[model samples]
Target: MYKIISEETDKSGMKVLNIDKSDLIELMEDYKDRKYFLSSITGVDMKDHIDVIYHLHNFDKNDYICVKVSTTDEKVPSITKLWKAAIVDEREQYDLMGITFEGHDNLRRILLPDDWVGHPLRKDYDLNKVQYVSVDRDGNEHVSFDDKEGW
Candidate 1:
């Protein structure tokens, strides 16, 4: 019971449906019951808002579809309950794009250190201020702006 804001076919001939954030969980649950597996989850910082995209595939039918939900608050429903693969996919999106997957069991940096500052994939991420990451003897990673401490 979700409304599709818009629908279009991408260059790859895959159907893409843009929907409201509130409809994501309900729609994905239906797709899961129909045997559609999650292919990936990614986010795009649209300057004004963020677009969280979910790619689903039905192997039995050899079909692919993408569900997109736009959020200015950078938050959306987590699909990890429906698809286990979404655990890592959502984490990557959260780490890189700063999109928070609400109801996620563990939403944290997957690629970057816990102390890493700023989401690098965002449109307004500062590139001039350099950050560094280093590992200690205990194998714990640390992020720092001071070059000497990081190195």
Candidate 2:
């Protein structure tokens, strides 16, 4: 029921299905109903596009499959409704890869502070600029590029 773009195997011999971003939720729902559990979500920065990978496991058969969708606009549908495990996984991807998981509730940084400037995992992330984090007396954290403010 998925509009697959291609099917391939990763180096580790895991099945990978590259499908359109629109079909992600439907395919995930079917997988969920078939007793497949969400293993994890990983994001890869391909420079021109971002690849979002969903790992699924079927405990009954001891099978594993990966679903991949590539996006140029850095957006994909959120599978959090079908898989509760996607809550944190999606957040992590969003935080580090700069991908926007559309319809994701509470989509925000899981590792970096809200004010952090950029997604460090992205290929184009600036390494020359230094960012600092400091907490104020009220226990509120602040992010800044200015070294003096951070101290």
Candidate 3:
């Protein structure tokens, strides 16, 4: 339950939007309806969940808007309705982060295989490590990663 989206400049003097998931589509539509171009869509993981951010720019007005939607829900609503470029971005998030875009046209893995085990962008995730280990110094063992390899 985030509040209204802001269009003010931050410490860097660049306008940014602190958008909530619910208001994502509306914000995107506002820019698209004004003939803005889709700039980018990226994902950020907050340990507990993932957030997909969309950036749009209206060259004529020199204005840019950012829209963010969380992926904690069982299904995240798609913004492809407002910006077609969202399709690829959302797919990339889903593939690597396990985020699902419910209203997307083709919600499939974009970068990883369909059978990927877990979200890779999470802070707790280990890239090249897998399984448990016991340090001889303390003789205390713990399972850090799941059963994969090289852990």
Estimated TM-score per prediction? 0.96, 0.95, 0.70
The candidates, ranked best first by lDDT, are: 1, 2, 3
Instruction: State which candidate has the highest TM-score.
Output: 1
The residue ranges of model 2 lying beyond 4 angstroms of the native Cα positions read none
Per residue, candidate 3 scores C-alpha lDDT tens digits across 1-151 of: 3366555665656567777777666766666778998888777887677777777788998877666666666356777787778789888878776677778889987765444556777676777765444343555344344544324
Q: What tens-digit string does per-residue lDDT give for candidate 2 at 99-151?
A: 89999999989998888998999999999999889998988789988879957
List model 1 lDDT by residue over 1-151, tens digit each: 8889999999988999999998999999999999999998889889999988889999999999999899998889888899999999999999999999899999999998998999999889999999878899899999889989946
Q: How big is the positional error of residue 92 in model 2, measured in Å on the Cα after superposition?
A: 0.6
Clashes of 3: 1
lDDT of 1: 0.92
Error of 3 at 89 (Å): 1.1
Q: Show pairs that collide, candidate 1.
A: none
